[model samples]
Target: MTSSSRALLFLLACICWVPVTAGAGERPARIVIDPGHGGVKEGAKGPGALREKEVALQIAHRLRSRLEAAGGEVYLTRERDALVSLTERVEMTNDHGADLFISIHANSMPTPRMRARTEGVETYFLSASASGEAALAVADRENSEAPMSRAARGDSTLALILDDLVRTEAHADSSRLAYAIHPRLVARTRAADRGVQQAPFFVLSGVECPAVLVEVGYISHPEEGLKLGRADYQEKLAEAISEGVLAFLKDTRRRDAARPAQVAGSQTP
Candidate 1:
């Protein structure tokens, strides 16, 4: 072959031999972290008046840092102690097209006496009815936003329909996500494992992707409340949560890779 032709053919061969990396065109996974309650809504109050909002935001910031370091894009619904509506939080998550949505909060019991008895980490996914009485109570507290309308608070037919659709589309993934993170959170903090449950948390509803709300610990408990206020403990919680998220994402990617590609014009009943 002529020198010029040989050179051209070699270049073409190299081009054809180039391999596409996994996730070549995929954008970094986007995660939306909603720190529960702020501004006038101090949420639950613990010993020494440690507000749930403050603790949630602190943990969220730490979680964001950890997730970012691990190559995920993260956004917080409210960076400051401002009142962000539940609708606004969901809108932010949907607008970002997040791969995962996590709402963070600290748990509190109805009475100081109950607080003393209860201490643990629990995660929740959206559902029409709460898993049990405890879950229902938590949902009621978390869903109590001042700006929410009476209709929003009530069990309207439309709301039920929407909830059903959300559950149908995201329930399995949401459950997996809750299970994935809850164990890590408990192990890292050496806190009690309250276990994962389903509840109708307003902040978690209407999210486009897998969504979960985590009660990292019971701030109402004297011992647990004090531990939650520590920077080292917060760091441990953040690290564990981040690790769990990474593991879930990796597993999802693997599952997707294993699935057969859909042929054009294919239909399923």
Candidate 2:
């Protein structure tokens, strides 16, 4: 098939996956979006002077508008070029009782050679560390600013997973959320698929709701970086991500409705 043919197919698929809205009696889902970095902490910058922080915030706004239109209560961690701590971000997500939380960021490479050679999309859920060196490196960069992120020991991953299970059932749903969002991103953007991964991302450490972090694309790659800076391309990214979240919510609502409701004082079984 031709490149244009494939692009057309993706656009049609996006249109088909119309976002499901809340019914008359159903409460709208709450979503919290965190744009990676801001203020002096501008995230990765690359070709065309594309800055991760700027792109992330722009995408967040687009996503918020899309989700709200689809009957969701959307909240952004930071509305402008301001810095917000990981704790603050998670606090907002939990306080809002968000059904889902998404942190948006752009990836970067350490060297010029690697920058030119690498570019793709990677979606991640909280994990101590997995997917080997690349994921670990990505985690390290994202976690660099989190004061205690570096102190975690190797075995701490398992411990954290167990602890998270007790804290919130969202831990289990997180991977499902990651898988849903990642494939849609790759399909719509036709970007290289780096596959779903997991790492001990400090920002996700405190989230009390289902959460996933998206490394939308490598800002360091010349071609992709220039595209990332474009408003039209950013809108496509937002639209694709919105589709994924809505699909996942649709499934969640179905499962919720299927479960037997508890009586006035009886236990759920």
lDDT of each: 0.84, 0.85
- lDDT per residue (tens digit) for residues 9-109 in model 1: 98865432221112667777888999999999998887897899999999999999978766678999999999898989999999999889999999988
lDDT of 2 at 142: 91
- Count of backbone clashes, every candidate in sequence: 0, 0
lDDT of 1 at 204: 77
Per-residue lDDT tens digits for candidate 2, residues 67-181, read 8877678899999999898778878888898889999999999898999989999999987656889998898899876755565534566465646554566877898889889
Off by over 4 Å in 1: 1-22, 146-153, 156-159
Quick one: best lDDT, which candidate? 2
Q: State residue 32's C-alpha deviation in candidate 2, in Å.
A: 0.4
Cα error of candidate 2 at position 147, Å: 2.5
Against the true structure, candidate 1 reaches a TM-score of 0.87
lDDT of 1 at 257: 86
What's the lDDT of the predicted structure labeled candidate 2? 0.85
